[model samples]
Target: MNDFSMLPPAGQNFWFIPMEEVALFRRFLKGKRVVVTNGCFDLFHVGHLTLLNEAKKLGDFLWVGINGDQSVRELKGDNRPFFPAWERAAIVGSLKGIDAVTIFTEKRATRFLSLVKPAVYVKGADYTSQSLDQEEKEVLNSCQALIKFIPLYPDRSTSSTVERIRKGSLMAEQNK
Candidate 1:
């Protein structure tokens, strides 16, 4: 039960944590509500920050699930994930509203729901309570987590960010 060596280094964030560590994570959530949200997070952007801030408001702690590199490749294709998995994870882990991060390799976050059993399941408003995709529907049906659809911010998304980055039109790239 004691594994100081495996603990994240001082100030170093952990993102791709294992499912076996859920118990330890739950210990941190004891008596406190937990919120969960899942995404590829291929590129960190304003949309992501908005969603995370909203998710944090729904619970005392927020846990974000990032799709693994292979999962992103399968979902987005070969030239996707503009950044590698570790880098993406580190970026997500460092976000202010995100208390913890983990990787989910499955196409759906169903298996993850069974493991985390968070009190709140946060999602983008693009999906409706009735129109949830099959896997998401399953989680809503069996999991104790309540589904919350946060409003999506218009004109701010990873796709748009990636395009901006590619055209050399983004001012942030100039500073980089």
Candidate 2:
């Protein structure tokens, strides 16, 4: 049997592994199919969960790469990522489907994807093969990782959630 003693206890197996330590986790995943997905996951919603579950179905191990706080700010603007990277990572790591979570500092998952070299790379349906980041696309191609797209939950997104919060706040202020 594989040595799972180093891993978190059952039901809390999802670990926030540092990039440098990813290789150690890989060793434990030997003989298992690995699936990787990346996103900001700022507000943790059903859409994100759905995608994650779908990705997990494609492989035995599910590794999620989360955008670090600075990366989120660069890609999503200053007001975005209301939740800090550590909190977001913790929330995602707590989910059932994820086996491991890594917070990456890059705006895209190119380097992370290269390092993990997962058997499959999953993305939301919103992104098409042509729309993928050039660097990410190149890395995935070089690694020969299969690209899979899972359908997103309609009308459920962090952006929409933020907008709702803003509108609610504005209305509350107006009433006061």
For all predicted structures, in order, the TM-scores are 0.80, 0.89
Model 1, residue pairs in steric clash: none
In candidate 2, which residue pairs get closer than 3 Å at backbone N, Cα or C atoms, i.e. clash? none
Alpha-carbon lDDT, every model: 0.76, 0.86
Cα lDDT of candidate 1 equals 0.76
Question: Candidate 1, residues 47-100: lDDT per residue as tens digits?
Answer: 888888999999988888877777788878888767766666677777767777
Best by lDDT: 2
| Candidate 1: regions farther than 4 A off | 1-10, 13-16, 165-176
Per-residue lDDT of candidate 2, residues 1-176 (tens digit): 21234445653657777888887777788888899999999988899989998999999999999998889999999887787777777778888888899988888888788888898999999999999998999989897889999998999888898889899999999999
Superposed on all Cα atoms, model 1 deviates from the true structure by an RMSD in Å of 5.1
Q: Best by TM-score, which number?
A: 2
